[model samples]
Target: MTDLNSKPEIDAPEGPAPEGLEIVDIVVGDGAEATPGATVDVHYLGVAYDSGEEFDSSWGRGQSINFPLDRLIAGWQQGIPGMKVGGRRKLVVPPHLAYGPAGSGHQLSGQTLIFVIDLLGVS
Candidate 1:
Protein backbone atom coordinates (compact mmCIF):
# COMPACT_ATOMS: atom_id res chain seq x y z
CA MET A 1 0.00 0.00 0.00
CA THR A 2 1.13 3.53 -0.73
CA ASP A 3 1.89 5.79 2.21
CA LEU A 4 0.60 9.23 1.45
CA ASN A 5 2.67 10.89 4.16
CA SER A 6 6.01 9.70 2.85
CA LYS A 7 7.99 10.38 -0.29
CA PRO A 8 7.63 7.87 -3.13
CA GLU A 9 10.23 5.84 -4.95
CA ILE A 10 10.48 5.40 -8.73
CA ASP A 11 12.41 2.56 -10.26
CA ALA A 12 14.68 3.20 -13.18
CA PRO A 13 12.83 2.79 -16.43
CA GLU A 14 13.81 0.15 -18.92
CA GLY A 15 14.06 0.67 -22.69
CA PRO A 16 13.46 3.96 -24.47
CA ALA A 17 11.39 6.76 -23.06
CA PRO A 18 7.75 6.76 -23.98
CA GLU A 19 6.56 8.98 -26.83
CA GLY A 20 3.73 10.47 -24.83
CA LEU A 21 2.46 11.14 -21.33
CA GLU A 22 1.66 8.18 -19.08
CA ILE A 23 -0.56 8.43 -16.00
CA VAL A 24 -1.00 5.74 -13.40
CA ASP A 25 -2.89 5.78 -10.14
CA ILE A 26 -1.05 4.31 -7.19
CA VAL A 27 -3.69 4.89 -4.53
CA VAL A 28 -7.16 5.92 -5.56
CA GLY A 29 -8.92 8.50 -3.40
CA ASP A 30 -12.61 8.74 -2.61
CA GLY A 31 -12.69 12.47 -1.96
CA ALA A 32 -13.61 15.36 -4.23
CA GLU A 33 -12.34 15.02 -7.80
CA ALA A 34 -10.10 17.61 -9.36
CA THR A 35 -11.16 19.69 -12.33
CA PRO A 36 -8.95 20.71 -15.25
CA GLY A 37 -8.25 24.15 -13.83
CA ALA A 38 -8.57 23.61 -10.12
CA THR A 39 -6.01 24.60 -7.56
CA VAL A 40 -4.47 21.68 -5.71
CA ASP A 41 -2.52 20.85 -2.63
CA VAL A 42 -0.08 18.03 -3.18
CA HIS A 43 3.10 16.30 -2.14
CA TYR A 44 5.26 15.13 -5.02
CA LEU A 45 8.58 13.63 -5.99
CA GLY A 46 10.21 14.00 -9.38
CA VAL A 47 13.00 12.02 -11.02
CA ALA A 48 14.69 11.75 -14.33
CA TYR A 49 13.60 8.81 -16.47
CA ASP A 50 17.02 7.84 -17.77
CA SER A 51 19.14 8.09 -14.65
CA GLY A 52 16.52 7.64 -11.98
CA GLU A 53 18.01 10.69 -10.28
CA GLU A 54 15.73 12.75 -8.11
CA PHE A 55 15.25 16.28 -9.32
CA ASP A 56 12.62 17.72 -6.98
CA SER A 57 10.41 16.77 -4.09
CA SER A 58 7.81 18.54 -2.04
CA TRP A 59 8.52 16.12 0.78
CA GLY A 60 12.11 17.30 0.75
CA ARG A 61 10.81 20.78 1.40
CA GLY A 62 8.89 19.49 4.39
CA GLN A 63 5.48 20.46 3.08
CA SER A 64 3.02 20.06 0.27
CA ILE A 65 2.52 22.69 -2.39
CA ASN A 66 -0.62 24.44 -3.49
CA PHE A 67 -1.03 25.78 -6.99
CA PRO A 68 -3.34 26.03 -9.92
CA LEU A 69 -3.09 23.26 -12.50
CA ASP A 70 -2.98 25.73 -15.37
CA ARG A 71 0.17 27.35 -13.97
CA LEU A 72 2.17 24.13 -14.18
CA ILE A 73 3.69 22.08 -16.96
CA ALA A 74 1.56 20.74 -19.77
CA GLY A 75 1.91 17.21 -18.47
CA TRP A 76 0.50 18.34 -15.11
CA GLN A 77 -2.32 20.30 -16.67
CA GLN A 78 -3.28 17.20 -18.59
CA GLY A 79 -2.53 14.61 -15.95
CA ILE A 80 -3.90 16.18 -12.75
CA PRO A 81 -7.53 16.56 -13.69
CA GLY A 82 -9.80 13.74 -12.58
CA MET A 83 -7.62 12.94 -9.59
CA LYS A 84 -9.02 13.17 -6.08
CA VAL A 85 -7.87 14.09 -2.63
CA GLY A 86 -5.97 11.37 -0.76
CA GLY A 87 -4.91 9.71 -4.00
CA ARG A 88 -1.44 9.01 -5.29
CA ARG A 89 -0.54 9.14 -8.97
CA LYS A 90 2.47 8.63 -11.18
CA LEU A 91 2.99 10.63 -14.31
CA VAL A 92 5.64 9.96 -16.98
CA VAL A 93 5.97 13.16 -18.87
CA PRO A 94 7.83 13.52 -22.12
CA PRO A 95 10.02 16.50 -22.94
CA HIS A 96 7.38 18.32 -24.91
CA LEU A 97 4.84 18.04 -22.18
CA ALA A 98 7.30 18.76 -19.38
CA TYR A 99 9.97 21.40 -19.89
CA GLY A 100 9.90 21.34 -23.68
CA PRO A 101 12.66 20.68 -26.25
CA ALA A 102 16.39 20.59 -25.49
CA GLY A 103 16.97 24.27 -25.97
CA SER A 104 13.89 25.46 -24.21
CA GLY A 105 16.11 26.85 -21.38
CA HIS A 106 14.47 25.07 -18.47
CA GLN A 107 16.89 22.82 -16.59
CA LEU A 108 14.79 19.73 -17.25
CA SER A 109 14.26 20.43 -20.92
CA GLY A 110 14.73 17.59 -23.42
CA GLN A 111 14.27 15.00 -20.74
CA THR A 112 11.45 12.75 -19.71
CA LEU A 113 10.44 13.05 -16.07
CA ILE A 114 8.61 10.77 -13.68
CA PHE A 115 6.58 12.15 -10.83
CA VAL A 116 4.76 10.47 -7.98
CA ILE A 117 2.17 12.85 -6.67
CA ASP A 118 0.00 12.63 -3.59
CA LEU A 119 -3.16 14.66 -3.76
CA LEU A 120 -3.90 16.26 -0.42
CA GLY A 121 -6.66 18.69 -1.32
CA VAL A 122 -8.43 20.33 -4.24
CA SER A 123 -10.19 23.65 -4.61
Candidate 2:
Protein backbone atom coordinates (compact mmCIF):
# COMPACT_ATOMS: atom_id res chain seq x y z
CA MET A 1 0.00 0.00 0.00
CA THR A 2 1.14 3.54 -0.72
CA ASP A 3 1.88 5.44 2.47
CA LEU A 4 0.73 9.04 2.52
CA ASN A 5 2.87 10.10 5.45
CA SER A 6 6.28 8.96 4.28
CA LYS A 7 8.76 9.68 1.56
CA PRO A 8 8.43 7.72 -1.68
CA GLU A 9 11.11 5.89 -3.57
CA ILE A 10 11.24 5.92 -7.36
CA ASP A 11 12.34 2.85 -9.17
CA ALA A 12 15.13 3.13 -11.72
CA PRO A 13 13.78 4.13 -15.09
CA GLU A 14 13.81 1.75 -17.98
CA GLY A 15 14.35 2.57 -21.67
CA PRO A 16 14.92 6.02 -23.00
CA ALA A 17 13.39 9.09 -21.48
CA PRO A 18 9.95 9.90 -22.77
CA GLU A 19 9.43 12.80 -25.13
CA GLY A 20 6.45 14.25 -23.35
CA LEU A 21 4.86 14.66 -19.95
CA GLU A 22 3.28 11.63 -18.33
CA ILE A 23 1.07 11.59 -15.25
CA VAL A 24 0.07 8.67 -13.07
CA ASP A 25 -2.03 8.55 -9.97
CA ILE A 26 -0.57 6.45 -7.21
CA VAL A 27 -3.31 7.20 -4.72
CA VAL A 28 -6.44 9.12 -5.54
CA GLY A 29 -7.93 11.39 -2.94
CA ASP A 30 -11.51 12.42 -2.45
CA GLY A 31 -10.77 15.85 -1.02
CA ALA A 32 -10.75 19.23 -2.72
CA GLU A 33 -9.52 19.22 -6.29
CA ALA A 34 -6.56 21.26 -7.46
CA THR A 35 -7.26 23.89 -10.03
CA PRO A 36 -4.90 25.24 -12.68
CA GLY A 37 -3.96 28.30 -10.68
CA ALA A 38 -4.47 27.09 -7.18
CA THR A 39 -1.79 27.29 -4.56
CA VAL A 40 -0.96 23.88 -3.21
CA ASP A 41 0.69 22.46 -0.15
CA VAL A 42 2.46 19.24 -0.91
CA HIS A 43 5.24 16.83 -0.05
CA TYR A 44 7.26 15.74 -3.04
CA LEU A 45 10.36 13.90 -4.16
CA GLY A 46 12.22 14.56 -7.41
CA VAL A 47 14.82 12.53 -9.23
CA ALA A 48 16.65 12.50 -12.48
CA TYR A 49 15.05 10.13 -14.93
CA ASP A 50 18.23 8.68 -16.29
CA SER A 51 20.23 8.33 -13.11
CA GLY A 52 17.40 7.99 -10.63
CA GLU A 53 19.42 10.39 -8.51
CA GLU A 54 17.39 12.43 -6.09
CA PHE A 55 17.55 16.17 -6.73
CA ASP A 56 14.90 17.62 -4.50
CA SER A 57 12.56 16.47 -1.78
CA SER A 58 10.24 18.19 0.58
CA TRP A 59 10.11 15.02 2.59
CA GLY A 60 13.85 15.13 3.14
CA ARG A 61 13.45 18.60 4.46
CA GLY A 62 10.87 17.38 6.91
CA GLN A 63 8.17 19.69 5.62
CA SER A 64 5.81 20.25 2.77
CA ILE A 65 5.96 23.14 0.37
CA ASN A 66 3.32 25.62 -0.73
CA PHE A 67 3.37 27.13 -4.17
CA PRO A 68 1.09 28.36 -6.86
CA LEU A 69 0.64 25.98 -9.75
CA ASP A 70 1.59 28.67 -12.23
CA ARG A 71 4.97 29.13 -10.56
CA LEU A 72 6.02 25.53 -10.96
CA ILE A 73 7.53 23.80 -13.96
CA ALA A 74 5.43 23.21 -17.05
CA GLY A 75 4.98 19.53 -16.40
CA TRP A 76 3.77 20.22 -12.90
CA GLN A 77 1.46 22.99 -14.01
CA GLN A 78 0.00 20.59 -16.52
CA GLY A 79 0.01 17.44 -14.45
CA ILE A 80 -1.09 18.65 -11.04
CA PRO A 81 -4.44 20.03 -11.89
CA GLY A 82 -7.38 17.66 -11.43
CA MET A 83 -5.50 16.02 -8.55
CA LYS A 84 -7.20 16.24 -5.21
CA VAL A 85 -5.96 16.87 -1.72
CA GLY A 86 -4.68 13.68 -0.06
CA GLY A 87 -3.71 12.25 -3.43
CA ARG A 88 -0.33 10.97 -4.46
CA ARG A 89 0.80 11.38 -8.06
CA LYS A 90 3.76 10.56 -10.21
CA LEU A 91 4.97 12.69 -13.09
CA VAL A 92 7.48 11.83 -15.76
CA VAL A 93 8.68 15.11 -17.21
CA PRO A 94 10.77 15.53 -20.27
CA PRO A 95 13.52 18.13 -20.39
CA HIS A 96 11.36 20.58 -22.22
CA LEU A 97 8.62 20.42 -19.68
CA ALA A 98 10.99 20.34 -16.76
CA TYR A 99 13.91 22.77 -16.95
CA GLY A 100 14.41 23.06 -20.71
CA PRO A 101 16.92 21.96 -23.34
CA ALA A 102 20.65 21.66 -22.73
CA GLY A 103 22.67 24.83 -21.97
CA SER A 104 19.62 26.51 -20.52
CA GLY A 105 21.81 27.37 -17.48
CA HIS A 106 19.78 25.69 -14.77
CA GLN A 107 21.57 22.59 -13.47
CA LEU A 108 18.56 20.45 -14.23
CA SER A 109 18.36 21.71 -17.77
CA GLY A 110 18.56 19.07 -20.49
CA GLN A 111 17.51 16.44 -18.02
CA THR A 112 14.27 14.54 -17.78
CA LEU A 113 12.88 14.27 -14.27
CA ILE A 114 10.54 12.12 -12.26
CA PHE A 115 8.53 13.24 -9.28
CA VAL A 116 6.24 11.66 -6.73
CA ILE A 117 4.00 14.18 -5.04
CA ASP A 118 1.57 13.99 -2.20
CA LEU A 119 -1.00 16.72 -2.08
CA LEU A 120 -1.96 17.91 1.35
CA GLY A 121 -4.06 20.96 0.55
CA VAL A 122 -5.11 23.35 -2.17
CA SER A 123 -6.49 26.82 -2.16
Candidate 3:
Protein backbone atom coordinates (compact mmCIF):
# COMPACT_ATOMS: atom_id res chain seq x y z
CA MET A 1 0.00 0.00 0.00
CA THR A 2 1.23 3.51 -0.82
CA ASP A 3 1.09 6.23 1.80
CA LEU A 4 0.42 9.85 1.00
CA ASN A 5 1.55 12.39 3.58
CA SER A 6 3.00 15.78 2.75
CA LYS A 7 6.41 16.34 4.32
CA PRO A 8 8.05 19.64 5.15
CA GLU A 9 11.43 18.62 3.75
CA ILE A 10 10.06 17.40 0.45
CA ASP A 11 7.27 19.92 0.21
CA ALA A 12 9.49 22.75 1.42
CA PRO A 13 6.93 24.75 3.45
CA GLU A 14 9.21 27.78 3.37
CA GLY A 15 8.41 28.65 -0.20
CA PRO A 16 10.22 27.46 -3.38
CA ALA A 17 13.44 26.30 -1.73
CA PRO A 18 16.95 27.49 -1.09
CA GLU A 19 18.73 24.22 -1.74
CA GLY A 20 17.30 20.83 -2.74
CA LEU A 21 14.12 19.73 -4.51
CA GLU A 22 10.49 20.44 -3.82
CA ILE A 23 7.42 18.38 -4.65
CA VAL A 24 4.73 20.09 -6.59
CA ASP A 25 1.51 18.14 -7.03
CA ILE A 26 1.17 18.07 -10.76
CA VAL A 27 -0.85 14.83 -10.52
CA VAL A 28 -1.89 14.03 -7.00
CA GLY A 29 -2.42 10.32 -6.49
CA ASP A 30 -3.95 7.74 -4.20
CA GLY A 31 -0.98 5.55 -3.27
CA ALA A 32 1.51 4.76 -0.56
CA GLU A 33 4.35 7.18 0.08
CA ALA A 34 7.87 6.55 1.39
CA THR A 35 8.89 7.37 4.89
CA PRO A 36 12.09 9.35 5.50
CA GLY A 37 14.15 6.23 6.07
CA ALA A 38 12.44 3.37 4.32
CA THR A 39 14.49 1.04 2.17
CA VAL A 40 13.01 0.26 -1.26
CA ASP A 41 13.80 -1.20 -4.66
CA VAL A 42 12.80 0.46 -7.92
CA HIS A 43 13.37 1.09 -11.61
CA TYR A 44 13.87 4.62 -12.87
CA LEU A 45 14.78 6.91 -15.74
CA GLY A 46 16.16 10.41 -15.28
CA VAL A 47 16.15 13.30 -17.68
CA ALA A 48 16.80 17.00 -17.59
CA TYR A 49 13.55 18.64 -16.49
CA ASP A 50 14.30 21.79 -18.38
CA SER A 51 15.68 20.35 -21.61
CA GLY A 52 13.89 17.00 -21.54
CA GLU A 53 17.17 15.24 -22.28
CA GLU A 54 17.64 11.71 -21.00
CA PHE A 55 20.48 11.24 -18.56
CA ASP A 56 20.16 7.97 -16.71
CA SER A 57 17.77 5.09 -16.22
CA SER A 58 17.55 1.52 -15.00
CA TRP A 59 15.58 0.65 -18.12
CA GLY A 60 18.36 1.78 -20.40
CA ARG A 61 20.73 -0.54 -18.61
CA GLY A 62 18.20 -3.38 -18.44
CA GLN A 63 18.52 -3.83 -14.70
CA SER A 64 17.04 -2.71 -11.42
CA ILE A 65 18.75 -2.09 -8.08
CA ASN A 66 17.85 -2.40 -4.43
CA PHE A 67 19.75 -0.22 -2.01
CA PRO A 68 19.39 1.23 1.44
CA LEU A 69 17.40 4.45 1.66
CA ASP A 70 20.50 6.19 2.93
CA ARG A 71 22.53 5.08 -0.06
CA LEU A 72 20.44 7.00 -2.55
CA ILE A 73 20.11 10.73 -3.10
CA ALA A 74 18.20 12.77 -0.53
CA GLY A 75 15.45 13.54 -3.02
CA TRP A 76 14.85 9.87 -3.86
CA GLN A 77 14.62 9.01 -0.18
CA GLN A 78 11.56 11.26 -0.02
CA GLY A 79 10.27 10.47 -3.46
CA ILE A 80 9.90 6.68 -3.89
CA PRO A 81 6.91 5.56 -1.89
CA GLY A 82 4.19 7.29 -3.85
CA MET A 83 4.56 4.41 -6.28
CA LYS A 84 3.44 0.93 -5.39
CA VAL A 85 4.08 -2.41 -7.05
CA GLY A 86 3.82 -1.89 -10.78
CA GLY A 87 3.30 1.81 -10.18
CA ARG A 88 5.18 4.80 -11.51
CA ARG A 89 5.90 8.41 -10.56
CA LYS A 90 7.57 11.51 -11.89
CA LEU A 91 10.13 12.97 -9.48
CA VAL A 92 11.49 16.41 -10.18
CA VAL A 93 14.77 16.62 -8.32
CA PRO A 94 16.86 19.73 -7.85
CA PRO A 95 20.66 19.49 -7.70
CA HIS A 96 20.90 20.21 -3.99
CA LEU A 97 18.69 17.28 -3.14
CA ALA A 98 20.41 15.16 -5.74
CA TYR A 99 24.18 15.41 -5.81
CA GLY A 100 24.52 19.01 -4.77
CA PRO A 101 27.23 21.26 -6.24
CA ALA A 102 29.79 18.46 -6.30
CA GLY A 103 27.49 15.99 -8.02
CA SER A 104 27.98 12.22 -7.83
CA GLY A 105 29.17 9.30 -9.98
CA HIS A 106 26.87 10.60 -12.73
CA GLN A 107 28.60 13.97 -13.08
CA LEU A 108 25.37 15.83 -12.40
CA SER A 109 25.80 19.48 -11.53
CA GLY A 110 23.30 22.20 -10.71
CA GLN A 111 20.77 20.50 -12.90
CA THR A 112 17.12 20.01 -12.16
CA LEU A 113 15.89 16.72 -13.50
CA ILE A 114 12.83 14.55 -13.88
CA PHE A 115 12.62 10.87 -13.26
CA VAL A 116 10.00 8.50 -14.62
CA ILE A 117 10.19 5.89 -11.91
CA ASP A 118 8.55 2.50 -11.81
CA LEU A 119 8.25 0.88 -8.45
CA LEU A 120 8.42 -2.87 -8.96
CA GLY A 121 8.27 -3.73 -5.24
CA VAL A 122 9.59 -2.94 -1.81
CA SER A 123 11.67 -5.32 0.27
Candidate 4:
Protein backbone atom coordinates (compact mmCIF):
# COMPACT_ATOMS: atom_id res chain seq x y z
CA MET A 1 0.00 0.00 0.00
CA THR A 2 1.15 3.52 -0.71
CA ASP A 3 1.87 5.76 2.22
CA LEU A 4 -0.75 8.46 2.38
CA ASN A 5 1.71 10.78 4.04
CA SER A 6 4.28 10.54 1.29
CA LYS A 7 5.04 13.75 -0.54
CA PRO A 8 4.37 13.89 -4.23
CA GLU A 9 6.69 15.31 -6.81
CA ILE A 10 6.26 19.05 -7.23
CA ASP A 11 6.71 20.16 -10.78
CA ALA A 12 6.77 23.65 -12.27
CA PRO A 13 3.62 24.82 -13.96
CA GLU A 14 3.51 25.17 -17.69
CA GLY A 15 0.43 27.42 -17.69
CA PRO A 16 -0.06 30.80 -16.06
CA ALA A 17 -0.92 31.05 -12.41
CA PRO A 18 -4.61 31.78 -12.05
CA GLU A 19 -4.92 35.40 -10.84
CA GLY A 20 -2.69 36.04 -7.84
CA LEU A 21 -0.53 33.45 -6.15
CA GLU A 22 -1.86 29.94 -5.93
CA ILE A 23 -1.24 28.06 -2.69
CA VAL A 24 -2.09 24.41 -2.20
CA ASP A 25 -1.55 22.18 0.78
CA ILE A 26 0.11 18.86 0.08
CA VAL A 27 0.29 17.39 3.56
CA VAL A 28 -1.76 18.89 6.34
CA GLY A 29 -0.19 19.25 9.76
CA ASP A 30 -1.83 19.51 13.14
CA GLY A 31 0.85 21.81 14.52
CA ALA A 32 0.73 25.56 15.02
CA GLU A 33 0.00 27.69 12.00
CA ALA A 34 2.51 30.18 10.69
CA THR A 35 1.60 33.85 11.11
CA PRO A 36 2.91 37.01 9.62
CA GLY A 37 6.22 38.21 11.10
CA ALA A 38 6.86 34.79 12.60
CA THR A 39 10.31 33.32 12.25
CA VAL A 40 9.90 30.07 10.36
CA ASP A 41 12.15 27.21 9.47
CA VAL A 42 11.41 25.36 6.27
CA HIS A 43 12.73 23.10 3.51
CA TYR A 44 11.97 24.36 0.06
CA LEU A 45 12.55 23.36 -3.55
CA GLY A 46 12.45 26.14 -6.10
CA VAL A 47 11.84 25.40 -9.77
CA ALA A 48 11.84 27.58 -12.86
CA TYR A 49 8.57 27.23 -14.76
CA ASP A 50 9.85 27.73 -18.29
CA SER A 51 12.19 24.77 -18.35
CA GLY A 52 11.11 22.97 -15.19
CA GLU A 53 14.63 23.32 -13.89
CA GLU A 54 15.30 23.28 -10.19
CA PHE A 55 17.12 26.43 -9.22
CA ASP A 56 17.39 25.67 -5.51
CA SER A 57 16.44 23.25 -2.79
CA SER A 58 17.07 22.97 0.91
CA TRP A 59 16.48 19.22 0.77
CA GLY A 60 19.41 18.80 -1.57
CA ARG A 61 21.77 20.13 1.08
CA GLY A 62 20.03 18.32 3.95
CA GLN A 63 19.46 21.55 5.80
CA SER A 64 16.53 23.79 6.41
CA ILE A 65 16.52 27.57 6.27
CA ASN A 66 15.11 29.98 8.81
CA PHE A 67 13.78 33.45 8.12
CA PRO A 68 11.04 35.76 9.18
CA LEU A 69 7.94 35.12 7.13
CA ASP A 70 7.52 38.82 6.46
CA ARG A 71 11.10 39.25 5.30
CA LEU A 72 10.94 36.91 2.33
CA ILE A 73 9.88 37.75 -1.21
CA ALA A 74 6.41 39.22 -1.73
CA GLY A 75 5.12 35.85 -2.87
CA TRP A 76 6.53 34.02 0.14
CA GLN A 77 5.40 36.69 2.59
CA GLN A 78 1.89 36.49 1.27
CA GLY A 79 1.75 32.75 0.76
CA ILE A 80 3.49 31.36 3.84
CA PRO A 81 1.00 32.53 6.38
CA GLY A 82 -1.59 29.96 7.52
CA MET A 83 0.76 27.07 6.80
CA LYS A 84 1.11 24.77 9.79
CA VAL A 85 4.37 23.53 11.16
CA GLY A 86 5.19 20.11 9.62
CA GLY A 87 2.94 20.77 6.67
CA ARG A 88 3.91 20.91 3.02
CA ARG A 89 2.67 23.43 0.51
CA LYS A 90 3.02 24.27 -3.13
CA LEU A 91 3.14 27.85 -4.30
CA VAL A 92 2.89 29.09 -7.85
CA VAL A 93 4.31 32.58 -7.78
CA PRO A 94 3.92 34.84 -10.75
CA PRO A 95 6.53 37.35 -11.82
CA HIS A 96 5.05 40.37 -10.02
CA LEU A 97 4.86 38.56 -6.74
CA ALA A 98 8.16 36.80 -7.35
CA TYR A 99 11.24 38.70 -8.47
CA GLY A 100 9.31 40.83 -10.93
CA PRO A 101 10.72 41.62 -14.37
CA ALA A 102 14.28 41.78 -13.12
CA GLY A 103 14.03 38.33 -11.51
CA SER A 104 16.73 36.81 -9.30
CA GLY A 105 20.14 35.54 -10.34
CA HIS A 106 20.81 34.40 -13.92
CA GLN A 107 18.62 31.28 -14.15
CA LEU A 108 15.45 32.95 -12.91
CA SER A 109 15.24 36.16 -14.90
CA GLY A 110 11.67 37.10 -15.74
CA GLN A 111 10.60 33.61 -14.65
CA THR A 112 7.62 32.41 -12.77
CA LEU A 113 8.83 30.43 -9.78
CA ILE A 114 7.27 27.28 -8.34
CA PHE A 115 8.12 26.21 -4.84
CA VAL A 116 7.38 23.17 -2.71
CA ILE A 117 7.89 24.06 0.92
CA ASP A 118 7.84 21.98 4.06
CA LEU A 119 7.20 24.03 7.17
CA LEU A 120 9.41 22.72 9.95
CA GLY A 121 8.90 25.21 12.74
CA VAL A 122 7.47 28.56 13.77
CA SER A 123 8.75 30.78 16.49
| Candidate with maximal lDDT | 2
Task: Return the lDDT, model 4, position 80.
Answer: 90
lDDT of 4 by residue, 1-123 (tens): 212233336654656655578898888767999998999998888887777878898877878899998788888999899999878888988787887776356446567788988888999
Candidate 2 stretches with Cα past 4 Å from truth are none
Misplaced by over 4 Å in model 1 are none
TM-score of each prediction: 0.98, 0.99, 0.66, 0.85
TM-score of 1: 0.98
Query: For all candidates, what are the clash counts?
Result: 0, 0, 5, 0
Best by TM-score: 2
On residues 1-123, what C-alpha lDDT tens digit does candidate 1 reach at each position? 777877898988999999999999999999999999899999999999989999999999999999999999999999989999989999999999999999999999999999999999999
Worst 10 residues of 3 by lDDT: 4-13
After TM-score superposition, what is the CA distance of residue 17 in candidate 2 from its true location, in Å? 0.8
Per-residue lDDT tens digits for candidate 3, residues 1-123, read 333222111221233423445444434434455455666666676776556667777766777767777788878887765545555566788887787664455677777766666555565
RMSD of 2: 0.5
Tens digit of lDDT per residue, candidate 2, span 2-26? 9898899999989999998999999
lDDT of each: 0.94, 0.96, 0.61, 0.79
C-alpha displacement of 49 in model 1, angstroms? 0.4
Cα-based lDDT at residue 88, candidate 2: 98
